[model samples]
Target: MFFEEHTGLHIDDQRYRGSGTSKANRMRGFWTVEPDHVVARVLLAMIAHATEYECVPADMDDALFADVHRIIARLNQNPSSPVPEVDAFTASVNELDFEAAAKHIRTAIEQNEPATAWIACTCFR
Candidate 1:
């Protein structure tokens, strides 16, 4: 819903391809020209949306929040770093507990820190 409403990207559950390799150990799923570019785009879009409107209520889950935080911390650590290792980053993202991340986002919104929430959520996405 958020992607559709904010970025016009209507990605459904079925379209969410799994990360990692296939049965043959070959990588699968779509590969962008630059993975970091994709991340930047999503983050920017999220920030723009959050800035333009009131905070929207979202689920807050613990495990997911931890994963999101991990990702964001990595990104923030070296904002100018070249495109990150796609496989490693994807692995980290796949390990996230979506429920926990949702909880974290909700907490951020409740605290009126929508920008932080947006960065976390977008990183996971």
Candidate 2:
């Protein structure tokens, strides 16, 4: 819930705008102190560096969540990698169920999967 509480600080519509340079900078301020924010920072950097057009809130969310689903599916399908937490989180995300995602995020945090916690906070918002 640490990242959840901080979501209001930088996860606004404005943060998803522009080329993501500003958001990446803002994310640096957090990840420097809290390494979990590296997920958000890296994602923002991808937008900032890879795209020619300015980023939009809905587009960014959709692209990110779409890839999230793909990654989760790949992980879940691999018999050697049984990630039930990721499965639950992806299920919550697929349903657009923010409350359920939050619970899974809390579980992720407790499980020490900070990257998942970051993704849940950034996407579910």
lDDT (C-alpha, whole model) for all candidates: 0.49, 0.52
The sequence of per-residue lDDT tens digits that candidate 1 reaches over residues 18-80 is 543442221123223224334444555665576478453366466875675577555444434
lDDT of 2 by residue, 89-123 (tens): 44433565866776777777666565677787677
RMSD, one per candidate, in order = 17.1, 13.4
* lDDT of model number 1: 0.49
Clashing pairs in 2: none
Error of 1 at 24 (Å): 28
Candidate 2: residue 92 lDDT (0-100): 38
TM-score of each: 0.26, 0.26
As a whole number from 0 to 100, the lDDT of residue 8 in candidate 2 is 35
